[model samples]
Target: MNPNDHRAALADIQVTAQDVKFSTIVCFLAWTFAVYDFVLFANLLPVIAQDLGWTAAQTTGINTWVTIGTALVAFFVGPLVVDRMGRKSGIVIAVTGAALASGLTFVAGWMVGALGVLGLVLLILIRSLAGLGYAEQSINATYLNEMFSHVDRKNGGGASRGFIYSLVQSGWPVGSVIAAASIAILQPLGGWELCFIVGVFPAFIMMALGKKLKESPQFRARQLVTQWRSQGHTAEAEQLAREYHIGEETGVSPLKAAFSGESLRPTLTLSAAMLMNWLGILAFAFQGTLVLTSGKQVNFNDALTILIISNATGFLGYLFHGWLGDRIGRRNTIALGWFLAAFAFAGMLWAPNGSYGLVVALYSVGLFFLIGPYSALLFFNAESFPVETRATAGSFINALGQVGAILGGVLFTIHLSGLTQESAAELISSTWINAALIWGTVPILLSAALMLLARDVRPGRQS
Candidate 1:
C-alpha cells in the first residue's frame, strides 16, 4: 500500500469515544431548539389571529409570505453562505437571526394597534426575517453528519443519530403542545401576544448553545487543504493528507467534483425522494391534526389533545426508523414507512364517524412514517456528497425540501377553501385522508427507486 493509505489507516485507529459524545450533544441540542422555533409558527397561527383581529385570509397570507420568503432565500443564497461560512458558523447565524426575528415579530404585532398599516407591515417584515433564520435547519443537518465517524455513522446511524434526532425532531410536537396549551391558557388573560412572547424564549436558549459549539472535524480537514495551498506546497497526495490531519490524502477533491457527472444520478434521485418526503411532511403539518378534529362543535382541547398524541407518537417513530435505518438500510426503512403510512391514512378515509380513536390511530401511524425515516436525512445527504461540497449539496437538497413545505401550505389552503358548508366535515375528512394517502405513497415510491442508485457511503468505507 502507498504511504498515503498507510497514514489514513493509522488516523482511523486513533479516533476517540469522547469526541463522538461531545459533538453529538452539541449538534443535537442546537437542532432541537431551531426546530422548536419553526414548529411554533404552525401551531400558534390560529391563536395569533384570534387575539390580533386578523382575518383568516390575512393570517394565511402571512404564512404564505414567510414560507415563500424563506424558500426563495434558502434556495438561492443558502448554498453559497453554507459553503463559504461552513457548518458551525452558518448554524449560529441561522439560530441567532431566527430568534431575534421571532421576538421582533411579537413586538411588531403589538405595535399594530397604534401603527395601523405600518404595524402590519412590520409584522410581515419580522416574520419574513424569522423565515430566513428558520431556513438554517437545512445547514445544521449537514453539520451533524460531518462531526461523526463512518462506523459510528452506520452502526449508531439510527440509534445515536435517531435518539437525539427524535428528541430534537420531537420539538415539533412539543412546540405544538406548548402552543396549543399556552394559547388556551393565556388567551383569557394575556391574549395571543403571550404565545409569541413565550415562543421567543427557546430561540434565546438556542442562541446560547450556538455560541459555544465546535466546527465539525470534517470542516477542519477541509481547512487544511487551503492551508496546504497557501503555504507554497505542491499539494502532493500524502502531504495534503498529513497537513489536513487525515492519514491518507485520498486524492479526493474537497469541493466534491465526483457529484458533478454520472454521480449526479444519485444526487437527483435522492433529491426527488427527499423532496417528496418533505412535501408529505408539509402536507401533514398543514392539515393533518387540525383538519381531522375541526368543527364548530369540536372542543379546542380535544383537538390539541389529538395533536399532542400524534406528535408524541411521531417522536417514537423517529427513533424506530433511525435504528431500522442502521440495521436494514435507509431505503428499505423509508419505503416500508411510506407503505404503512399510506394504509393508515387510507383508514382515516373509511373509518366511521365519532370514531376519534380510529382517526387518532390512522393519523398517528401516518405521522410515524412521515417523521421516522426522514430522520436520517442529514446522514443520507452527508454521505451522498463528497466532503468538498458536502454543505452545499445538503443545503440545496434541504432547500428543495423547504420548497415542498411551501407547496404543502398552498395545497392545504386550496383544499380547505374548496370545501362548502353543507359537506364540510365529510369533505375535510375525505380531503385529508386522500391527501395523506397521496403523500404517503407517491413519495416513498420515488424514494425507493432512488435508493437503488445510492453509493452507500455508510461511513468508514472508502467510496
Candidate 2:
C-alpha cells in the first residue's frame, strides 16, 4: 500500500482518548451489572429454595441445570449471535434479556399459590433465561481487548492495560458487595422476591450505556474488508488486509478457526484450566452460602458480614494481580494466585468453631487469591486468539468452565445427600478439611499446572 492509502486506513481505525475512556466505563459497567445479576441469585438461593419447596439436593440440581443452560448458550449460541449482530448489539440484547428474565423472578413468587409445582418450573425457566445472558460477559472481554488494541500495542502498555483490565474486573466484587448489601437491607423488608425486583435495575442501566458504544475498530475493519471484497475492489481489500495483518479469509467460522491447527493446543489447555478454576470457585460460592445460612458454621448475620469483608478484600486482589501479571507474566501470576488460594482454603477448613476472626481472615484471603487472576486470564485468553475468533474461543473456554461448575454442584449435592442431617452437619463442622482438599486445593493446583502448559499471550510478549 502507498503512504496515502496507509494513512487513510490508519485514520479510519484509530481510536481517540475519549473513545478509550468511554469504552472502558461502559465495559466496566456491563461487567458490574452482569455479576450483580449472577451473585444476587446465589445470595438469595436459600430463601428461594424454601419458598419453592426445594431441598438442598434440589437446589443444587437447579444450579446444575442453570449452569448447563448457560454453557450451551455461551458455547453454541454466543459465537453465532455475536458474530452476526456485532458485539455492541449482542450485549444490548443480552442485558435486556437478563433484565426481563430477572423481573420474572418476582412473578414466579406470585404464581406459586396458583400453579404450585409449575411455579418451580416457571422459575427454573426464568433463571435459565437470565443465565443465557452470561454470554455478555465473554462478549465484554472481547470488546475490551479489541477496543484498547492501539493502547495495548505501545511499549510498556502491557502493565497499563493490565491495570485498566483489573479496574474493570473489580466489578465482580463490587457487584458482590451490592448483592450482600441488598440482601442485608432489602430482604428483611420485602423478602427475597423484592430483591430480585431491585436486581433488574442494573441490567437496564447497562443496556442504556451499551447502546452508546461504538463497534470495535477491528470488527469494523473486518467488515470493511468484506465489503470491499464483495464489491470486487480487490486492491482496496488487499491493502486493508496487509495494513491490518488480517488474513485473506477473515470471515471463517469462529469454531472452525478456534480449533484448527496451532490455535487448538492453547484453546484446549485454557479450557481445561478454566474448568478446574471454576470447579474450585463453584465449590466455595455454593458451599459457603450453605455453611453460612445453615448455621453449621455461623449465623446468617455473621456470614453476611464475613462475606462482605472478604469480598471487599478480594477487590484489591483483582487490581494487584493485574499489575503482577504484567510485571512477572500471566502464567506465573496466575499460578501464584492458585498456590496462595490453596493454602488459604486449607486455613479456612481448619479454623476452630469459635475463631471468627481466623475464619474470616482465611476466607477473605482465599477469596482474594481465587479471584485475583481472573481478569488477567481474560486478557490472556483474548490475546491468545486473532480478532476473527477471539470472542468465540474465549466464550467456548468459559462454557467449559460452566460445565465444571455444574459438575462441582452435582458432586456437592451428592455428598450432602449421602449423609443424615446430623452427620452432614458434623461433617461440615469437622471434616471441612477433607472437603477443602478435594474441592479447593486439588482443583486449583491442577489449574496452576495447566497454566504451565498454556503459553502466555500478553500484549507485546511473544508466545
Candidate 3:
C-alpha cells in the first residue's frame, strides 16, 4: 500500500465527533431499557409465580424454559442479523424486539386463566425475545469499537473511550434499579403487570434512535474488501486490508470465521468465562431479593430495599473498572474484578449475623466486582475479533451466558424443594447458604480464572 492508498483507507474510516456521541447515546439508551425489561422479569418473578399459582419448583422451571428459548433466539440476532445485515440494523431490531416482549409479557398474565399452561407457553416465547435485548450489547460494542478506533490514546481519547463505554455499560445497574423500584412503586398502584408496561415506551424511542445510526466503518471496510477482491480489483482490496487490518478469514462465512483459525481460542475461553460468570449473575443478580430473603439475611419487604440500594452502589464499580482497564488492560481488569467479587459474595452469605447494613455493605461490594467487570468485558469481546466475525463471536459468547443462566436455574431449583412450602415472604431454606455458595461464589471464581486463559484485547487482539 502506498501513502495515498493508506490515507484513502483512513479517510474512509474517519467519523465525525457528532456521529460518535450520537452512537454512544443511542447505544446507552438502547442497552438501558433492554436490560430494564430483562431485570423487570427477575424483579417480578416471585410475584408472577404467586399470581399464576406456581410453586417454587414450577417457577424456576418456567424461568429455565424461557432461558432456553432466549439462548436459541440469541443466535438469530448476532449471527444472522448483525453479521449478515449490518451493525445498525441489529441495534434497531434488538431494541424493538425487547419492547415487543414487554408488551406481550403483560398479555401473558391475562392468558394464564384463559389458556392455562398454554399462556405460560406464550409467556415463554415472549420472554425469549429478550435474546435480542441481550444480543444488543455485542452489536453496540462492535459499532462503538469501530467508531472509537480513530481516537488516539496519547490525546486521552483512548481512556475517554473506556470511560465512555463504561457509562453505557452502567445501564445494567441503572436497569436493575429501575426494575426493582418500578415494582415497588407500581405494584401498589395496580400489580406487577404495570411494571411490564414501563419498558415499552423507552425501548421504542431507542429503537427509533437506533435506526438513524451510521453503519460502522469496519463493517463498510470489510464489505469493500470482499467486493474488490471478487471483482478482481486486487490492488484496492489489499490496500484497504493493509490500512484497516482486515482479518485473514475473509473468505469464509462470518459464523464459521468465528470458530476457525485466529478466532477460535478467545471465542472458546471468553465464552466459557462468560458462561461461568453469568451463572452467578443469573442466580444472584436476577433473583437478588430472593437470595437475601431465602438466606434469612433479610425478610421479603426489606430485601427489595436492599436490592435497590446495593445495586445503586454497584454503579461506581463500572466507572472505576472502565478507567482501570484503559490503564492496564481489559482482560486483567475483568479477571481481577470477578475474582474479588466471589469473595465479597461469600462473606455476605456467611456473615455471623445477617444484619441489614452489613448485608447491604457486603452485597454492594460483591456486585461492584461481579457486574462491573462487564464494562470492560463487553468491549474486550468486541475488540477480540475482527469486524467480520465480531458480532457473531461476541454474541455467541453473550448467548452462552443464557446457558449459564440455565445452569444457575438448575441450582436454584434443586435447592427449592425445602424452601417451597412457604410463600416468598416467609421463604427460608436451610440449604440456602450451600446453594448460594455453590451456584454464586463458586462459578464466579471459575469465571475469573477462565479469563486468565484468554489473550489480551488490544488492537487487532483476536487470537
lDDT of each: 0.60, 0.75, 0.81
Score residue 157 of candidate 3 by CA lDDT: 56
Model 1 C-alpha lDDT per residue in residues 249-283, reported as the tens digit of each score:
44544335435754476567676766766666655
Model 2 clash pairs are none
The regions of model 1 sitting more than 4 angstroms off are 1-16, 49-61, 76-78, 111-121, 132-136, 150-181, 235-238, 241-259, 295-298, 418-463
Show model 3 residue runs off by greater than 4 Å: 1-13, 153-157, 248-250, 352-354, 422-427, 459-463
Ranking by TM-score: 3, 2, 1
Candidate number of the best lDDT: 3
Better of 2 and 3 by lDDT: 3
lDDT value, candidate 1, whole model: 0.60
Candidate 2 residue-wise lDDT, 340-448, digit = tens: 8978887776666768888889888988998888878887887788777777888898788888888777776675554443456666554444554586568987898
Going through the candidates in the order shown, the clash numbers are 8, 0, 1
Task: Give one digit per residue, the lDDT tens place, for model 3 in 256-344.
Answer: 88898778999999999999998899867987866776675576668888888878878889998888888888899999999999999
Alpha-carbon RMSD, candidate 3: 3.1
RMSD of each: 5.3, 2.9, 3.1
Off by over 4 Å in 2: 1-12, 112-114, 152-158, 250-252, 294-296, 420-424, 427-433, 461-463
- Residue 69, candidate 1: Cα error in Å is 1.3
